[model samples]
Target: MLANSSIDNAASQAKTMFGEELIWLFIFGDLCTFTLFFFIFGHARTNNSVLYHASQAKLNVHFGSINTLLLLSSSWFVVRAASAARKGLIQKCTRALAGAFILGAGFAVFKIIEYIDKANAGISFSTNDFFLFYYLLTGLHFIHLLTGLSLIAYFIYNFRANGITRQNHATFESGAIFWHMVDLLWIVIFPLLYLLP
Candidate 1:
């Protein structure tokens, strides 16, 4: 009984330090999955250097660069949002989250335009080994971006309604953490798919 009580107390302390258990679990799982995918992509690229390089050259570096910038800026906004929330600056936090969401939307628009161009040019996942990795990796990252946008929107709405307080700051922090992960994944994806010659 004493051991059980100690364990329970430790778990409670852990929760306090980690913000939320479920969010940590999800982040860990997603990171592991992305790490595996990245490893596979690297191995494949090594085996098909010429194909990968050639196909990579066909990608629009300008668009990829712009998207990277957008995501990085959006991540900054997310961080600012969380910081503002911690300070109980509801209006500042809401504006920061909104900015992040708008930047994420711009990223989606640019990605769609790039996809349309690729389709018009007859390039797709089945085009080649490089294109396959490119599509799979970037497509996955794009889905995450869309999800992050939704999370940001939800945060915005919640902030405007109830606002973030010390009691509920964990919820805001969780959203910010997820948004940073999405941005970090893109930072890796952009270099691998667009500029890693």
Candidate 2:
């Protein structure tokens, strides 16, 4: 009886820390997808080292670095927002979330400009295997950023109107978790796509 009770308590604690089962399922699915893509990219690079390196050289490192900083700053604001929500500081939380959203928007703008420049240079996904991965991976991450921005907007509206309190803090935390995942994905992508040559 004691062992069973202990096991049950551990499971309860895990669920509480991880959030809703559906969210965990979504996150795990995304992780698996990205992991597979990364593995394929690595294998391809290994098989075609010269082509991969030559293609990687054509990428704009400066733009990639700026976007990295933007996402990192946005993630910081999200952390602050979550902390403010926990303390019942609705105004502070709203401001932090807004900052995060703006930084995320800045990332999107920079990415669009980069894409435009690449297009002008006659680069397309079909140009090479490296370009194919570049476009597919970064484009997927961009979609994730847009989705996160929408979620942040909803949270901001909720904070302004209903206010985040201890009772509703779980919702804020869950959103933050999703935003952090977006940031984490970019961090992995930036190094692999830009700096790994």
Candidate 3:
């Protein structure tokens, strides 16, 4: 009975920490998808190490580094915002969300420029297997970032439009969770695509 009670309490805490079960389900499914993609990329790299390493050399590590910093900063802001929301500090939460959105936007712009630079250099989707995976992984991650940005924007707008209150704080928590998910995904993607040997 004691063991069952302890397990139930831990489960309750997890549910409370992560918010809605639906979102957790979505995150879990998305993570599984990314894991599958990671396996495929690793298998391909093992099979064609020479081509992979050569193509990786063509990628601009500078852009990747800058984007990494941006995402890390934005993720920090998201953590701040979520913490602020928990404290019922709506103003602080809004400001942090704004910071996150701006940094995330900067990441998107840099990514676009990187894509353009590659195109100008005659790199295209059909360039080779490495380039193909590069585009696919980064492009999909970019889409996820955009979605998180949109959620942040909406939360900010609703706060400003409706005036600050604790009523919708749970809603803000949901969005913040998604933003962190995107950030964590990028953390894995950065080293995998840019720094992996």
RMSD, each candidate, Å? Answer: 6.2, 6.3, 6.2
lDDT of each: 0.82, 0.84, 0.82
TM-score of each: 0.88, 0.89, 0.88
What is candidate 1's lDDT per residue for 39-80, written digit by digit as tens? 999999999899888888889999999999999999999888
lDDT at 114 for candidate 3? 98
Q: The CA-based lDDT of model 2 is what?
A: 0.84
**For candidate 3, lDDT tens digit of each residue in 14-87?**
46675566777888998999999899999999999999989988888899999999998999998898776655
Q: Which runs of model 1 end up more than 4 angstroms from their true locations?
A: 1-18, 166-168
lDDT winner between 2 and 3, please give it: 2
Kindly give the stretch of ten consecutive residues in candidate 3 with the minimal lDDT sum.
1-10
Task: Identify the runs in model 2 with alpha carbons over 4 angstroms from their true place.
Answer: 1-15, 165-168
Clashing pairs in 2: none
lDDT value, residue 194 of candidate 1: 88
